[model samples]
Target: MTANPLADDITQAAACLGGDGLLAGEVQGFAARPQQQEMAAAVEQALTDASTLIVEAGTGTGKTYAYLVPALLSGKKIIISTGTRHLQDQLFHRDLPTVRSALGVPLKAALLKGRANYLCHQRLHMTRSEGRLGDRRQANQLEQVFDWSGRTASGDIAELSNIPEDAFIWPRVTSTTENCLGSECDWFSDCHVMKARREAQDADLVVINHHLLCADMALKEEGFGELLPGAEAFIIDEAHQLPETASRFFGMALSSRQLLELAQDAINEYVGETGELDGLPDVARELEKATREFRLEMGQGEQRAPWSRLDGNPALTEAREALKTALADLAIQLEPLSERSRGLDNCYQRALRVQTLLAQTTEQPPADYIHWFETWRQSFRINLTPLDVSENFNSQRHALPDCWVFTSATLSVNDSFSHFAHKLGLEDATTLQLDSPFDYANNALFYVPKGMPEPSSPDYTRHMLDETEAIIEAARGRTFVLFTSYRAMNLARERLRDSCQFPLLVQGDAPRNELLERFRELGNAVLLGTSSFWEGVDVRGEALSCVIIDKLPFASPGDPVWQARIDAMKEGGGNPFMDEQLPHAVITLKQGVGRLIRDMNDRGVLVICDPRLLGKRYGRVFLNSLPDMGRTRDLDDVVKFFHASDALSL
Candidate 1:
């Protein structure tokens, strides 16, 4: 047998991460961790052999540096994907530089986000000339963006922090795949999206979020050109989120917002370029009215339901027909005007795409897809999600590169990676699990409160809040009360508002980052939040001392997409609860419990108020999946633990 030549790099990579090595001499207070070094060796081996590797490095494992050192040493053109845009920024602007500088490697890097993140010069100009603002405030916001456009070089909206990311004005000033005129755009020379992609193509390393990666995968599936440059290796930082994100992009979606935007754009183009002929403006206005009427028929409040729910309702049926007719009328009117200008041509193509998706949605869905609709306050989305994305995701992975590394903190359940592997059809990949180097055994306490009602009971939130109040008081209000549902979080907020004394911060009262900043600054505030707060949150030192979970984080049976998958699993001769639901819940619970004990010196109590943790048979799966902390059922033990910490602090 021939010896592998690149195997020497594994040892070199591990040595560089070791004590008395390059990093130890460069970074201050950088303690050498055995787990991080082991992970770096495994990543190096994967890169050398051009194979697949999965690693679940627990919290505080320094996974970022572990994968990065090997990637830089290999000198391969690499693409690193993160779970969120904020993480992308952190890795590109902060972590990447630290590692590259420590290794003294001169690798060029780039940060690429989706097109929507960059401001579109053409759209900004059209929005300014159209003068169709909703109010005076929107007009002022447009002027602010316009003024900043000249001074900015990158055109990334994140650079302008005066306007919120979710402000209504952003949609008017940005572009999407549907509305963006590729090379025909007037501002093609100065396009921010193109500029970012060009940099990514030229750099040796590119950092992007999951959305852009999946978008490239879906585009390739459609035989379109790739959005990303070819790379020798792809390292997914938060691999646990890949399957879900891939499923979304692999499927199809048509939104009411897209339809309304097409209508408005068509009217604007007609006024600017085309003559007032054939009642084109009137037809576009009809589409606007039909879209709003259809939204009204979806009923009040946010909701998600299977498309079959519209089978028997006559009003919904009529509204859908009106929407379809309005779209067809607009398409017919714009087909002739497409040659008038590039903007009209883009609108015509968008209208046809929406028409096709609408027709497919109203028909009998394919056997392998779940047809569902979701609605919010002002918009709705009709989605066709695949029942199993294993085949599709596997194909995309194979097409990408010879080497792949999928690493995350919560990718395994009960110390096994089978569930995650099966989701993405990565059964052949090598797997490794590295426990956190933090002192969880000595610093953290896992408390499952006694006398808790069933999670489904009407009085569950009331009782859970009643118990959490005492713990918050004992911990001096440095607590995060994480819930599985908005209903529960809101109820806890309402009850605590009257009884608790500390500063209360709720999720909807402000933005997520804003709420987190307040929680840290107050030093003694109780923060209530839902699923978004479970993971991707960091609080160290004495600021955060307790975490209270209302229940096991399980997929709700009421969700249409989840229910469809559960039913499909049953039909395929699988135990829906055991094979699917239980494993998913175990992984999610691990992420929630991971909020505490971020550092070696951090000490806190983890409170699971769900009685099922002790009452059900599968509860052991969840408990075993979490870190090996001291477990207790007594409330007095928690109070005493906090009291001991307070004395030590003094």
Candidate 2:
């Protein structure tokens, strides 16, 4: 006779992980893994004790199901948050359902995205009432969304697969916190966002992303139904991204794009509300003009300068004052008009929010902050980012008396969770590390080329191109040449443009998803990318066999944020390089390397061309952090691994 799976017995949790209990004949191709069972047991224990748990479940530990099975069967309200919406969707729509069916647990699960994702019925009505938002392409895109809004059960913009989310028209028809009418919205009765939140409020489980989690923590910004106070367990997937993302939310930011959008939203609201522009449209236009001129005055390209820089420079100070005055003037004009339209009232609130944000950005950086301004992609942004968000994170952690579980494939480096734990204020949490189940000795090779110069050398790109091309030849074009910067990625892409025979897919040539699809379809292709490609990407099989990292993934010293963190770490009797930077880089590198051997049958070569990884003493940390793949310097060994992988694929 089997014991109750819901009991606090860890053995029962272990049994459910097997094929005989809840998983009996329900999980196809089930292979019982001890490491998975161990992690599951740990999660179950944490839930029972209502304690915090930090789990570094390496690739192939089946960590998702390990935690989910216990959480669902516990019959407690659990909130699972991931670093990205893509992973959130996977857990809620795919993995959770699979586990729930097998366990036969009577659990209610809900998927809640940030408000920007859900269609604002109020905004949609306004968009229709005010026609032709942009060019013909944008018009067509809006028409498609208009059609999708009618049929989408979830009202998630992700449902409209044909139109890209970054389309210029999407913002005109979406609501931001600044612009949302909240309960005052005429369409509040049928609000998709509120409805989704209501589901989460009533659910046994809710899956959300890090941004929303952080937002909810800092300000109850989402108001997406209270989380920590209600859920019995908090499980954070891809926990490595939590600290940095939390830092962003805890900081202050004001973008020209956001102000411009506010201005535009105001214009749309005026037209939609009174069915006439009537002097209000001119106020928004003037503010936009001042904003554009201000952006130009901030200068060309990405520039990060201190508040002192802005104070001393006449052009910057003038631009700053002009923009500030314009925003205030815009608010003044909106006061009377706000009474005319509730939409205008929303826009009025948006202007005031921007004013507050701009003021926050211009102020002196608080004790643990780094402030700067930068222009990227033709938009100027000002930021005052926190040097540490641990305190803020801990506050959220204590908001409810519940178990907290942090799990990721690459959270710990050198079998130590101090770096990840301290970063997220989880120093006292229980930590566990599980290695990949795959036999990396036979399936993968960790190769480092002999006698390579430092990455700082001018000849780095040329040498990297030479060595990467050779590796691609050995792998027969199933390669991902990961770079540390855009300069290197573009340099290698240009050099390999004509030399390679296989389809050469560059990162910016198309959308990341499209690039991966093309790489898979081509079966043998070389894709070159920078930071964005390093993580959250999964390509199983021989289509991706060789991963060639150009350099040790280091945070650039030039970044104002990195500089502030280094200073902060130094102030606390710590070696910033050893304590903060190195561990972070090792985790990132592990993520890149883990891409090679995804499944049990998968086989590949991971060639890191950075020689500093061999010369530097701290490089031992990275070496120790990666999977225990068979090490080799011989190019022929890479050739052999690729041949074996290719044969297996065939």
Candidate 3:
């Protein structure tokens, strides 16, 4: 009989995660979960077979260790991509070490982030010599970065905790693909991005985020040098976010910031190389002026509108034309001086690329693409996003011919993987859905208040706040009130300011991490937030005892991307609501609901304020997608749940 080495490998992985095995015995307070062990076995099978696998391990399934143990034990080259950089760091620094230690596996691991996260030594020196800062504060921050740059090894900006990530000085120091001088750079040998990529290539396991993964995929599609190393297996931890992240990367964008940066770089390079701003500064300034004027003509307030809205507006159209002409003039000027210096040459190439993208963006979009523009306070971005990213993503997946595992707590809508699989075009993938090991039936309560008005009514916010006040009083301020729109969140903040007794933390008041820290510390704070607060937020135990949602999280019809997809679906004789919109909302709502019951010992109440969950026919889909918990329409039951918790504490 032939010895099955792959089967033996999977058996060893399961044993390590089993009840009386390595993790259970060696790791402190580690309770072995059957679901987690099952997931590990499945992951091992996929790794050994080199096949595609989609698994939805519900909350508390220990999915991190589930996949990590197998990948570490498999001894194959692996790349694990997370949803955000924070998660990437957490897995690399926290979870991976724990699992490897328990399994006693000796493996090389590395963490690689996007280029923007790393400081560019070339750009930093240029910024210092240029001495162009907005204010004294920015100047001081630049010096702080300079001081730390010398002591740092990895060049990751997160190390300089004193400077906020959103500081204006960072952009002046970091390099983007458009501005980075690859081989011609004087600091190419000491480049942090290059060093990280090299380490990733050498390591047996690599940790990265979704944006970097998608960026590498995009670069590969364009026939550029790949940002990541070829791997035998790829594990996407937060698989739910990949489709959207891929959309952004697979698409093309022209932003006001890119144009403004080009203008500034041109002037800086010309002055540095020629020692005088003879004729280039004026042309560069024209480009800057035109970019700002075009932004102003777009609108007064921040908005996202389709490019078609510019059809009848002559002033906006003229501004856009003037902007394009300014870009053309600058490109013509830089063409003559392209050989002056590498900096000038790079700027010339960037100018031409931006010009091409601007023309393509403003022109009629190609098939399967949606042309739209979004504006902020002082900047705007014209984007061309594909209506469906599945085709591109599927092609990339098939091109690799490697093991791919997509796992998330919310991938399945109504206990089916069809929605998520269809989005990513996973044609032939094995699927697994493991319910959480948490005791949700006894510890959680799902509530939808009675006597609520339609979400479209003007009084809906008022009514929603009224119901939330009752739940807040019951839960004693341990609640999260998530809204679908910023308008609703702001209104709730204003109304609850005078009425609610608990400490209220609004989203925009501070950084998200700070807000979450305060919420966890206060133990009785009610956080009011919008879309960002719904997912990627984990607050276990009693700090977060309730989650209050304002409405069904349907993608806004006003959003250009969503509208385009809806139109395309309708044209194809598909039910846009059921086929496209509803699944998206169900997935989003599940994210919101996930914040409630994170662990087995956690007890909480979930209040979804939208009456549509019970009033409409499509409500059953949303209801069926959530965890099996006790349901109620009365406020007394919610209050009793909390009171019982108080009794236990006493």
Candidate 4:
């Protein structure tokens, strides 16, 4: 009788993980962790049993491999989705190869990004034929991409190392669903997007981010969007972000950029398909002019309004009517060539979508949705955002595979998965909670200054800066002063610049990756950042010793969608503040605190200046949710701890 080979392989893989592992004999600095092994076993079981598992493995738990090992060993095809592209690129390019080598499994894997990430050869050719862009910089950048386009095999814009991600030229060279001519394009034979999709469809494991997964699920009717139809299992790492990201996918939005882009494409396609009819350019100009007038009336820089405010404006009404009239005329002109060219068909389809969205914005939304308008400098967008995505999200069982696993360190609030489970509509899933293996008692201190002003107080920022001085000095500037708002961050940047000798790195000084790299090299720099810095950021050692949070991470009440949801909850006799807001803030705060104490040997100070955590009744939620560490009120204890660490280092 032959024993099961997978059983031995699993055991061998487990053994090879830490000090006793086979790799340890060949490599240096490997220590076996019981948490990793335990998690791997649980993951294996979850995959085998076809059960939904929500596991919270804390920092230093070796979570990536914990799930990846079981996923690789299952032999069943799985789609592992992460919250960020950096993690997606890491797993597909780095981590998966190492795991496959360790386990000796040759399972196939591929990385799939959205269509916009790939360069469209047809679009590049079209841009070149259209002549130089007005600006010298724009024309030069276009020429640079033209040269690089010939050399890039993958056609990934990310490979353009010299260019910034926000480069204006990327939009002109990349393909969007609205402008892509599909099989009718001349470059169809060598399309990068189609080739990537072929790899994804053929591989046993497909690595994707949350946005792509949501798109695949949302756009199932499109043939290429059927990326998940054949997979046997699903694993969503960083499951806490899934619910929020899912909302954006489930919602409907029509931006003025979409309108203008469609208008521009209509003009170009009309010329390509039929050599420029007399009225074609005029039709496109009318649409663009309407958008400009609409935006002019909307006012700008950043503002959100309920549908009533936008709909009530006479200029906006006149602009929408003018846009509708222009689109109707454009459709009439393009009707003759729509059958001859897929490009014209695509433009007509976009026109239809724009018309439908324009008409729908004036109508009352369904009871479960909130209709709102937002404005930026160049565009005004109307959105039919879902107030409650649970029902819509839960109805996606048809889109998912049988085996499901959702894992993250911050999924649970107050040591239970109720909040995450309820938010994501995953009620009956099996739950597991694993605390961090770090000795936080000895390695970390939680400092809340005594007699701090409340967050709502006008003097809060000034007072918080006063409290921050001691801790910043104690850690000797290895600090991340995280803020809930740009207002707080800017204020801190202003006050702290004069108050301290330590160099300060503000969020917008450079890109996030550049800033993080600079922070590590600077050694004693105090980095002030908000939202994006809180999660998916890892800095090991004393480089990031302290994390100071300005306030609880509550969603702004002024947010149209948030306010609508809050109103709905109130009407239904639920406390939106307690049920929805608190749990969310707890999870977010956990992510911010997580930046400190990243690895087993790392040490840091966590100073939260928000008085709500001490003065309010709901503060207990935060206190209970955070990792248990040594607590302090006096500044001397922090200084002494730093002194002791410095002495030990000497």
| Count of clashes, each model | 0, 0, 0, 1
Root-mean-square deviation of every model: 2.6, 3.2, 2.9, 3.5
Q: In terms of lDDT, which candidate is stronger, 3 or 4? A: 3
In angstroms, give how far residue 89 of model 3 lies from its true place: 0.5
Model 3 CA deviation exceeding 4 Å by range = 1-10, 220-229
lDDT for model 4 comes to 0.83
Model 4 residue 227 lDDT?
67
Q: Write the per-residue lDDT of candidate 1 for residues 24-43, one digit (tens) a residue.
A: 87788888888888889989
Worst 10 residues of 3 by lDDT: 1-10
Any residue pairs clashing in model 2, and if so which?
Answer: none
Q: How close is candidate 3 to the true structure, as a TM-score?
A: 0.97
Candidate 4 runs further than 4 Å off: 1-18, 22-28, 132-134, 220-224, 274-278
The whole-model lDDT of each prediction reads 0.88, 0.84, 0.89, 0.83
Off by over 4 Å in 1: 1-10, 220-229, 275-278
lDDT of 3 by residue, 146-182 (tens): 9988999999898887788789999999988878888
Model 1, TM vs. native = 0.97
Q: On residues 1-650, what C-alpha lDDT tens digit does candidate 2 reach at each position?
A: 11113335456677888757676557788888877888899888889988888887878899998999889878888889988888888888889988989888888899998898888887777777777565788778877888888898888888886777688877766777877888888889888888889899999899999999888888847757466588778888998888989988888888988888788788887777667766778888888998898888777777766554565578877888888998998899888888876778888878888898887887565667878777775788888888888888888778766588899999888988888888878778878778889889888899999868889999987887888888999888989999999999998878899899888999989988999999999999999999999998899988998899999999898777887788777888889998888988999999888888888888888999999888989889999888887998888877887777777767
